[model samples]
Target: MVEPLRPPPRSARDDVLTYIKTLHGHQHHDQLVAVRSLFTWAKQNGLIFRNPAGRIKVGQYEYAMLQPLVPVQVDRSVAVATTPATRLILTLVAVHAARVAQIVTFMLNDTDLGNRRRTIAGRVRPPDDLTTQRLLDWLEHRHRRWPNTANLHPLINNQTANTSSRAGSHWISAAMRGQDATLERLRVDRQLEEARVKGPDPLHLAEDFGLDEKTAMRYADSARAQLPQAAEQPSQ
Candidate 1:
């Protein structure tokens, strides 16, 4: 949620910032152009001395994807995960490639235990056997630890279970602290593993994780790039 600096008034008017925030994706560019044209018109009509919008800067939306970590590193992380909650969090990230944010917001209602499917960010994805088992373990642990807690989020600690708030990203990632692979590295490695085993098709990555096309392409391309390097590495 880190944002670049604001327009400083000399660059653009307040309404332009307000307008950009209301739109999504490509609409930001379209809306900004409209505002710039309005300012240009006002300047030509002698209403304003200068077009602040003319000096306004806009940049294309960008996403950065991390390269996959060594497979053995992630394996060590999974092996070291001992607690039910830690194991479940590791499984979700390593197996399902769930984002920390998405995993944190997950509610008890999001799970269909009998069906072995869970709704994450409005998408229904089935957990593999290991993930399902870890989830059950975590549920049992949570229930035993705090039976009367009203907090709905499935992932909760003593502090969070007492209230309605969910676990933070720092807390969740720190669950695997000192491990070889962090949650982010594990998540990227999951997608890369898929692309390595299957074909490195952007469509497949997009479909699997509900990723945007650009994000999918980056993961796919990284997988394709890593394959040859993996082959070249000396056997241990």
Candidate 2:
């Protein structure tokens, strides 16, 4: 049986760099990071030790760069969000591809209906989860203060708020929802990729990809149709 690699204690920090390098290049690089974190935690607990990872050269391995998501993927993820505000936030993150702080500030300033105004005075900062909720509560209170307003939007948090249970849940909810959708899609894609690598049948592959049996069969059929003649031929 294969043993799982766990991070070493802080007292072992001085020797961690060597231990990290013991595993394969990828494992060494990833595990070393985890080890360094543990070492930092250990240091706080009075396990004083020299940080071996800091001292060691990290020039051996090239870092992996993630590819940007396509517009369709971004749209699909945003569509999964429960509310328009959340969806819009998700789209901005996945489309405009702005940072979370920028997204939060933009939406907050844009949607500020209160007498008080918040502007990008200096460095742009996104509000924390609590702040977002506070803003929602504030808007709801203001709407209640002036009931039966000419503009119906004074009462709605997002366009789809009334229909969504997650309405007024978070200020950065659109971004949050988009993130959840993105993760779910990635997980589905990853499972599908793994099933392909394992060469599973359509039914199994469908189950893995969260597809119905008919859809799985159709997908498999399409794949079979696309395979090269030589690859599809029986062994000589």
Candidate 3:
């Protein structure tokens, strides 16, 4: 009988890189940092002979240049939203580039509809008038549905005090049927819009969006790629 083959054992660095490759974008970078920290701790305590993840460089920021939704798609999504809460959530993401996590975890005190601003993930974001109005309408609906619930989150379902990312994604996806729209894609579109208007300043992009330099540069690169196509279009 032929002997069965066995795979070779992976070193800590190899293991770490393999795991990192499985993730994408900022998540991959975050996981790499965590893995490096764990390995460093292990080395300091003599748990491992050396810090295997120490010298591993962060993965390159590979920009996926997806076509952004046009103005008509945005308008249609807003018009077709099933409920006030769904409309508000879609507007927040499409207009303000708010992350699903930030929207789900948003506190009542963090919002100032009068000023058209809200603090999301420690950053103050100013939503446009339409978004602010949608939020106001949703809050009224939410209050009517669940009075005296004591939940701080603005968006809530029948079962949970706080909405989850999964729920928010599902709501937006349903509202955006027949259109290519997602929270992450909306964020990228927002970033690209900013880059086009602001002349692709990587440093400013990084600071404004709370992203690392490399990731910001990737946005700048993608934005630069679109300039020629934009310029080629005939003026109306």
Tens-digit per-residue lDDT, 96-154, candidate 1: 88999999888999999988898887788866798788989999999999999999999
Instruction: Please rank every candidate by TM-score, starting with the best.
Output: 1, 3, 2
Which ten-residue region of model 2 has the weakest summed lDDT? 116-125
lDDT of each prediction vs. the true structure?
A: 0.83, 0.47, 0.75
RMSD in angstroms, candidate 1?
11.0
Candidate 3: the clashing residue pairs are none
Candidate 3, overall lDDT? 0.75
User: What does candidate 3's lDDT look like per residue over 62-147, in tens digits?
Assistant: 55674556987666666767799878877777666677767767778888877768887788875678878898898899888877
Clashing pairs in 1: none
Q: Which stretches of candidate 3 lie over 4 Å from their true place?
A: 1-66, 72-76, 161-174
lDDT of model 2 at residue 110? 46
Model 2, C-alpha of 98: deviation from truth (Å): 2.4
